[model samples]
Target chain A: MSLDFGLIIEQMPDILSGLWVTLWIWVVASILGAALGFLVAAARRYGPAPLDWLLKLYVEILRGNPFLIQLFLLYFGGPFIGLRLEPIPAGLIGLTIYASAYFSEIFRAGFQAVPRGHVEAAQCVGLSRSQILRRILLPEMTMLVLPQCVNMAIILIKETAILSIITVPEMTMVIGAIGSQQYAFVDAMFLLAIFYWVLVEICDWLGRRAEAKLSKFRFAVT
Target chain B: MSFKLFELMLWAAGYTVVLSAISIVIGLTIGLCVCAAKLARSRALSIPATVFISFFRGVPLLVQLLLIYNLLPAIGISVPSVVAAVIGLSLCTAAYQAENLRGGFNSVPKGLLEAADMVGLSPWQQLKRIRAPIALRLTLPALVNEAILILKASSLISVVGVIELTRMAQNLSASTYRPLLFYSVAGGLYLVICWTVAGGGALAERLTRTSRA
Candidate 1:
């Protein structure tokens, strides 16, 4: 089949709107996930025993199951809990929760990689626990966390496509609608793939650049 | 509503297990082949194999599932939805498994191959007797992890209307309007399956460690 530049151009604006929804989903999910991930990481690190156990269980439950199932639970199950969320909100919540679990593990890895000697040195200088955490631990952890975080972000972005199943107006949903409407299944899907590819490539590029920047610090440390 | 939800959960759980098992078997076989081809010396074979691995690895599984389930029929091969889902999952899982197996292969010492050759072993015998056993042992942990990942990913098959665990949860929620209870149960089942797989991986790792010592 010949490539259809004309059809692509014609569909560009509509696809852009769908892309906007996808971007919104990614941005919201990333922020919430990062926040929740940090909290879980901190809890697992410094919280009391019961809280640590709870956080551990939360992380395992979220990581062990598929995001699609979590999406179903939230989109369909929220109503039974007396909180009826819209499709977009439900999808975002589910993705955020799922992403948090993965990111928390990444965060924990980063935190553990921070040498205990460094924290001990900070203590020698009379830095309080909170001060050491804020000043030394977090700055060092960011370098370790950023690369994996960016990779997870790409995964989360692609995952948003699954939300289309719950009637969220993301890019995949748009592709599905267009395919059904115009009987342009192959064309619409090809376009959709391009959209996702571009997003993933951009995220990967950013991740590599960040990793490069972080590695320079490693050289200085050694 | 309660009884119906219980029935749906049981039914869906059964299908999920069956699908996961089939995909794992197919995926492991194809993955080993692709991994071997990738590690082969022939540029002609390795280059295409590498490209195939990257193509599947790069795209999301959901998109691949859609492409296989919805788009393939238009190209004249009308696979059933279940078949398409299985193929899509197996293909995706194989790409990951191939990468994992390549790591195991790389861990095999070059001296072993030379030793096998000095003993007048054929290439096939060297691979079967010297390479496969050690590689499989080293890679067992990673293979188990991938199995769990594939099992969880199989839930995506429900998108094409396979009556798997996730789909059953969706159907039950709609029918009973008791979404919380049904979904929680479905989610619980998934957790159990994954935890069991993970526990098995840990056991295998421990056994391997003891054996090596």
Candidate 2:
């Protein structure tokens, strides 16, 4: 089959719209997941024994299964429990939950990397818990966690493609729909790959820049 | 869920495990070659390996699967769904595994290699005794982590029509109107399989540590 730029040009508007949906999903899910994940990490670190066990189980089960299965369960299986949702909402929730499990682990590692003596020292100086968190923990973690969190952002961006499976009309879904109609499957597939690759490369660049800036700040502080 | 339906899911779960196992094995083999190429002195070898790792690692596996499934037909080499699935998974994992291997090898101490050289060890002997063993030990955990990632990723092969665990769950749920039941069962099956693999990896790590000591 001949390669066709004309077809992709014709579908540019649809492709752009699809890309927008992908960006929206990726941004919202990443932010929400990171926020929720930070709390989960903190709770697991300092929460009660039973609560820690429950969160551990939650994290393990989510991490173990595929995101596809989790999405299906939430979208298709939710109706059984009288919690039906539109495909996009279900996808957003599913992705947020999936991302939190991973993000929490990253945060947990960041927390662990900080020396316990620092927290103890802050406490001895009559620092409040929030003060210690702000003055001691957050600064120490800023550099360590930024890179992994950015990596997670890239992963979440890639995962937005999977939302197409549940009919979210993202870039992949648009490509699939147009390809079937135009019979330019190969070109469509390549175009889809380029879209994702560009997104990932941008994230990688941004992550590197942020890490550099943070490292400078870290050095300045010390 | 009915016993019959559960049995079908169990069979499908078996397929998932087998598919992931085969792909990981093939991927690891390809990974070694790519890793070697990446570590080679020549630009020609290293450049292509770098591009391969970047493309596979950057693109989502779903896109890769779709591209392979369709591109094969366009190139007049139409493959079955299972073949396409395996090819997609293997190539994708190979890239990640190559990076992991490169990291492991890079971590091998320069002093240790120099010591081997001083002992009159040939290059091949140094590779076999000093480099390979240290890299393997350093990378064992990452390898197991990749294996589990591949196992979870294998679920995406269902998109190409391979009736593995997730796809089987979908079909059963669609037919029986028991999405919750079947989906939960599928998730549980995946959890058990992943945990077992992880446990085995831990055990292997322990054995290797003792042997090394």
Model 1: CA > 4 A from native:
A1-5, A121-131, A219-222, B1-5, B108-131, B210-213
Report how far off residue B131 is in candidate 2 (Å): 0.6
Q: List the residue pairs that clash in candidate 2.
A: none
- Candidate 1 lDDT tens digits, A198-220: 77777888889879977877623
**Clashing pairs in model 1, backbone N/Cα/C closer than 3 A:** none
Residues B1-213 of candidate 1: C-alpha lDDT, one tens digit per residue: 467668878888878988988998899899988998999999988998887786677667888888778777777888789999999999988988899899988888898899899999999999899888888888898888888888889989988988899888878777767778877888889998889889988987887752441
Q: Each model's DockQ?
A: 0.54, 0.86
Q: Residue A114, candidate 1: how far off, in angstroms?
A: 2.4
